[model samples]
Each structure stands twice: as structure tokens, then as C-alpha cells.
Target: MAIALNTLVEEAERYLNASRIQDYCPNGLQVEGRPQVSRIVSGVTASQALLDAAVEAEADVVLVHHGYFWKGEDPRVVGMKQRRLKTLLSHDISLLAYHLPLDVHPEVGNNVQLARQLDIVVEGPLDPENPRTVGLVGSLVEPMTASDFARKVRIVLGREPLLVEGPQMIRRVGWCTGGGQSYIDQAIAAGVDLYLTGEASEQTFHSARENGISFIAAGHHATERYGIQALGDYLARRFALEHLFIDCPNPV
Candidate 1:
């Protein structure tokens, strides 16, 4: 069965309640491609390569984590943005994106997915007051060495994760998938022994060492892939629509 773009948008909006949370980019539909969507292609970013893949697959909808029209981005349609939009428009592929909402959703969120993979039971949001707080605090099913936990992350994420060992066996942890290294201090303040995120800066290494907290930088793209894919699968199953998660490799 084919789903109407409006219906899909309404369903997703209700599911995430994205409008309630202030985000960097306009959430939901950024680019209108087609009226009816029977097939969906989900990816981490709506880059040119991703657009090409979606076009090749004849995808009726392209759902992504990183959509265009970001805050501080040049509003003018030019350069790479122009090319990307042109491709989607020309191919009639609708674009749907969710940023913080996809990261924080309880069941189909990136953080929750990663925690489940690592057998981490979420206690609560790291920032109790902020509903949009991306990082989460949780505990492992059983205590394990920092190195052991690190190995588990690498195995699950299918990438070599950078690790910074701390003074304790890893029981409690804080994690935010996709370029959220800045939340390290929050984890430390929350009294978590370990913190995990995708992408790392030079300062991240020093912060983990000095803050007395373990750190792991699993690949940003890899760690974030699960949420949107799971969401797409759910949507497909719910609406009886065709869905394909198109993965575009990103090293950083």
C-alpha cells in the first residue's frame, strides 16, 4: 500500500512530537518530492551521494537524520545544496528528516538503540529538566572492565571504537550517538563512569583523561544508522509501504 506524504508526515510528527523541541533544522519534511510514497530510502545524511542512491533505487521518499536548511546555513539555493535539491526534485523523491527527535525517542532513538545493543539499561535522561537532552544515563546488565565494554561497542557498531579507560569497572554509562562529544562533562557530572559518543576532537581525549571518566568514540555514521533504519522499518510495517535503508559511508 502506498502512503500519502501528508499522512506520513502527520504520523511522524505525532510519533516524535518534533515541533515541541527546538532543533537546528526544520524537522519533518524539508523537501517535497512526490505526492504519493510507496518506497522509502533512509540514510544518515541527505548528501549528494545519498540522493543519487535514492534516485537509482527509485525511492518515493528519502528519510534522513541530517536534512538541509540547517540554522546558519546559506538559505540561497547554490552549490552543493542546489545540486542535492535538484536531484531529489528531479527524481520526485520526498525528503523527511528528524534530528534531535530521532536521537531521543525512547524506542527508535539512536541512544536507546545503542544502549540496547550494549545491554545498557537506561535509568533516565542525563539532564533531568531538559526533555531534548541528547545524552542518557544507564547501567550495564553486569559489571565489566572498561576494555571489555569497549570491545563490545566496537563489535556491535562494526567499527573500531576509540577508548579511554577510567578507574572503575564500567557499570553505569552515559551515551549520545552522533557527534555529541561535548556532552562528556554532563556524564561526568551525572556520576557515570563511562561516556560514549560518535566523532571525537583532540580535546575529547584530554577531557576523558582529566575528568576521571572513560570515553569511547564509535564512528558517528555507524552508531547513528540504527535509529532511522528502525524507524523506517516501523513505518513500512505500519503503513504497509516499501522501505530501503540506503547507507552512505562516512568516516568521520
Candidate 2:
């Protein structure tokens, strides 16, 4: 039996606490689809290929980490936007996305997932004052060398981590999932031995050298893929819906 689109949206809204947060794009139902949803397809980004895969799979909804209508993005829906929307509308497939909300959610968030994978016990948010802060600070259950931690991250994530080694043993570590190099300062302020995130900017090299805090830039797409995968699995169990995670490799 298929669940109502409204029901699924409501579930997502509640699970993510979507209403309380300001996001880049609308959190749920960016495009309306059929009233009933039996199958869902998820991806890291709502790219053209992903949309096509969802349509082919007969998915009622396509859930993603990144959707359209970003802040300061072009409002005009002309070229890429027009095509993406057209396909969904034509097939009556809904598009639902959760950005930072998904990134920071305590249970299924990117940071927490990465922590779980790397065996880190998350104490709390890296930025204590902001609930929306995507980074987290915590200690390992058993302290290990920075190199060892980096190896664990690489093996668990199946990607080479960009490591800027600082101290001998890394007890306190701070991490954010995707493209979070900007939060290096936040991690340093939290007094962590190592800071781990997805991508790095050119300036990040300088930040590492000057701040004396170890930095790691794991692959953006690789680190981010886990959270939404967890989210999709959760939805599948809770809703008894058929869900598939579409993997599209991205080096960046």
C-alpha cells in the first residue's frame, strides 16, 4: 500500500524539525507529485541523472541533501531548473530535500554518522550557542594518534582523508561532514586536537599552519553520502516504504 504524500512530508518535517530552521531551499515538497507514495529514491544532490533514475524506478518522491533555490541563487527557472522541474511534474514525482537540518539532526545527521563510523563519542555541538551548527566536538572512547584516526576515517569512509597532523594523541576531535572547511576556526576554538571535514579551500592550508590545529579534508561527496543514506534507511523502516540510495560518484 502506498502512503499519502502529505503523510510522508509530515513525517519528514517532524523528524528533521524542519519548520524551526531557515534553509537554503524549501525543506519538503519542493515539487508536488502524486497523492500516494509507495517508493522513494534518494541521492546526495538532486542532479538531472538522479531525477531520471527516480522517474525510471517509478518513485513517488525523490529525496536529496541538496535541492534547488539556494540562497543568492538565480531565481529564474530557465535552463537546468526548467528541465528538472518539468521531468518531475510530468511524471508526478515529488522532490523533497533537507539541507542543514539533515546535516545537524542528532540521530541521522552527517556529523553524527561520521562520528559513529569513526568511533567518536560526540559530547555536543562544536558551536554550543547555535543549534544549527553542523560541526560537532567530542572525544574518542579510546584515544589514538592523529595518523591512526585518519586511517580509520579513510577505511570507514573508503576515501583518503586530507590530514594536517598537529599533536601526538588526538583525544578531542571536531568534525563536520561536507565542505565545512570554514568551521576550522570553530573547531580550534573548541580546543580539539584534530578538525575533520569534507572539502578544503586554498586558504584552509594557511588556516591549518597558523592555527596549529590538525585539519582533515575528506571527500565532500563521500562524507556527505552517509547522512542522507541513514535518513533514507530510517524512512524505509518507519514508513515501510521501498527506498533506494542512488550512488553517483563525485571526486570533489
Candidate 3:
């Protein structure tokens, strides 16, 4: 089955509530391809490798969590950016991306998906007063040592997480996926036993040590890989179209 490009974009935007969230990049269709769509290729980032794979797959749309045109970036179309745009334009493959919306959605969000993967029972937002906070607070089924919890993260994420072992066991936890080390302070304020994010800053170690909370920096790509796939699956099931996820692995 096939649906109109406009219809699919509208439905996705509505489902994710994309317009309501302010993000660094544009949240909807970044590139126009064909008028009708039947197959989609999904990925974490719309890198050249993913685009090449989508072309090989004969995809009508290339759906991704990361897309082109961010704020403060040089708007001039040249170099790597030009090459990427040219590929999409030449192949007539649409690019649909969702940033903050995909991160914060209740059901298919990165945060919720990660929590489920780690067996954490979600309590609420990390910052209850802030509606736009992307991090979440949750609790494990049973308390475990900081090292033990890091091992679990490694098993679940298929990557070794950098852990700053603190004095507390991991029961109450806080996490924000993908370059969210800045939220460690917020997690500490919430009185969580552990805080996890995709990447960590130099200051993150000090903060966790001082606050007596365990901290882990799992790979950013590893953490964000699930939400885009889930979104693609939802779209494919909704429209009865074929969907494929092509992962371009990033160690960072």
C-alpha cells in the first residue's frame, strides 16, 4: 500500500507533536522526494552511508532521527552538505526527521524505550516543573551495586558504558539519552542513586563523585538507535508499507 507524501508527513508530525517542541534542527520533512511512498529506510542519523544504503534498498523515503539544516550552522550549501543533498535530490528519496519530539514522546520515545530495555520502572520526568525536560527518573526492580548496573547497561546496549562508581547502590535512577551529560546535576538534585546518559563531559565525573551518585556514559549512537526504528515500525504498520532500518554504527 502507498500513501501521499503530504499525508504521511502530516500524520507523523501529528503523532510526534513535532511543532510543539523547539529543537535545534527542523523536525519534519527536510527534503522532498516523490509524491507517493511505499517503502521507508530508517536510521539514527542521515549520514552518507545510510543514504547510500537507502538508495540500494530502493526506498521511497529515508526516515531518520537526525536530519539536515540546524540552527547556527553555515546555511551555505557546499562540501559534504552539498554532496548529501545531491544524493537525495538525484535519487528522489524523501527525508523525514524528528529530533526532540522523538526523544520526549510518551510511547515510542527514546527515554521510554531505553527505560524498558534496562528494566527500569519509570516514575516521572527528571524535572517535574519543566515540561520540556527530556530526562526521566525511574527505579530498578531490585537494588544493585553501581558496577552491577553498569554491566547490565553494557549487556543491554551492546556497548561498554563508562562508569563513575559512587557510594550508593542503583535503585533510583535518572537518564537522558544522547549528549545529555549536562543533566547530571539535575539528576543529582532529584536524589537518584545513579545517572546515565549517552555522553559525558569532564565535569560529569566530579559532579557524580561529589553528589555520591553513580554515573554512566553509554555510547550516544547506541542509546538513540531504538527510537527511530520504533518510529519506522509504527509508520510501516500504520500505512502497510515496507520499512527497513539501516544502522550506521558510530562508536561515539
Candidate 4:
């Protein structure tokens, strides 16, 4: 079965509530291709390799959490950007990207999906006052030591996270998927025992140590993989279309 490209984009926009959120990049269709989409390929990012995979798979559209055209990115299409756009245009494959929208969506959001995988009971937003808070504070089903929590993250994400240990036992925790280490301040302010994000900055270590909160930097790709998969599966079921999640591994 196949659906119109516009129809799919519209449905995704509605489901993710894309318009209301402010993001670094535009959310929704970043590039247009074929009008009718039958097979969709989903991934964490729309890198050149993913585009090549989509072309090889004969995909009608490529859906992803990260896409081009950022706030400060160079406008001129050249070098890697030129190659990537060339591949999509030559093959007539549509590109649909959702950044913050995919990270914050209630059902298919990255943080919520990670929470489900790790058996976290969400308490509330990291910042309760901000309605669009992308990070969340939660508690584990059972309290465990910081080392044990790091072990759990490694087992689940298939990558050893950089652990900044604090406190003996961790009960309440806060997390945001994909480069959200900066949210540690909010997590600290919220009084959570631990904080988890995909990547960590130099200051993250200082913040974690000073605030007495455990911190973990799991692989960015690993932490963000689930949300796009969930969204792809939903789109497949909802539209009765073929969906495939292409994983292009990245250590960071």
C-alpha cells in the first residue's frame, strides 16, 4: 500500500505537534521527492550512508530524527551536503526529519522510550514550569548503586557509558536523549539522584561532581535509536505501509 507524501507529513506533524515547539532546526519535510510513498526508511540521522541505504532499498521516503538546515549551518550546498542532497535528488527519495518533536513526543519520544526500556517510573518534567520541557525526572523500579546503574545502561544500550559517579544509591533520576547533557543543571535543581544524557561536555563532569548527582553519557546514536523506530512502526501500522529502520552506528 502507498500514501501521498503530503498526507504522511501532515499526519506526522499532527501526531508530533511539530508547530508548537521551538527547535534548532525545522521539523517535518526537509526535502521533497516522490509524491507517493510506499516504503519508508527510518533512522536517527539522515547522513549520506543512510541516504545510500534508502536508495539501495528503493525507499520512497527517509524519515529521521535529525535533518539538515540548522540555525547556524552554512546555507550554501557544497562538499558533504552537496553529495547528500545529490543522492536524494537523483533517486527521488523524500526526507522527513523531526528533531525536538521526536525527542519530546509523549508516545514515541526518545526519553520516554528509553525510560520504558530501562524500567523507569516517570515522575514529572525536569522543569515543571516549562510545558515544553524535553527532559524528564523519574525513579527506578528499584534503587541501585551508581555503578550498578551504569552497568544497566551498558547492557541495555550495548555501549559502556561514561560514568560520573555520585552518591551511593540512586533512586530518583532525570534524563533526556541525544546531546542533552546541559540539562544536568535542571536535573540538579530538581534534586534528582542521577542524570543521563547521550553526550557529555567538559563542564558536565564539574557539574555532576559539584552537585552530587550521578551522570552517564550513553552513546548518542544508541540512546536515540528507539524513538525513530517507534515512530516508523506506528506509521507502518497506521498507514498500512512498509517501514524499515536502518541503523548506521555511531560511537558518539
Q: Pick the candidate with the highest lDDT.
A: 3
Model 4 residue runs over 4 Å out of place are: none
TM-score of each: 0.96, 0.94, 0.98, 0.98
Per-candidate Cα lDDT values, in order, are 0.89, 0.88, 0.93, 0.93
lDDT of 4 by residue, 1-252 (tens): 999999999999999999998999999999999999999999999999999999999999999999999999999999999999999999999999999989888899998999998899988788998776789999999999999999999999999899999975999999999888888999999999999999999999999999888999997899999999999999999999999999998999
Which residue window of length 10 is worst by lDDT in model 3? 126-135
Off-target runs (Cα >4 Å) in candidate 2 are none
Model 4: per-residue Cα lDDT at residue 214:
94
Higher-TM-score candidate of 1 and 2? 1
Considering every candidate listed, which one attains the maximal TM-score? 3
Q: How would you order the candidates by lDDT, starting with the best?
A: 3, 4, 1, 2
lDDT of 1 by residue, 1-252 (tens): 887899999998999888988889999999897799899999999989999998889899999999989899888999998899899888888999999999999899988988888899999998787665788999988999999998998788778889989888888999999989988878888999899999889999899999888999998898899999989998898899998998888877
RMSD of each: 1.2, 1.5, 0.8, 1.0
lDDT of 2 at 190: 91
Pairs of residues at least 3 apart in sequence or in different chains that clash in candidate 1: none
Runs in model 1 deviating more than 4 A are none
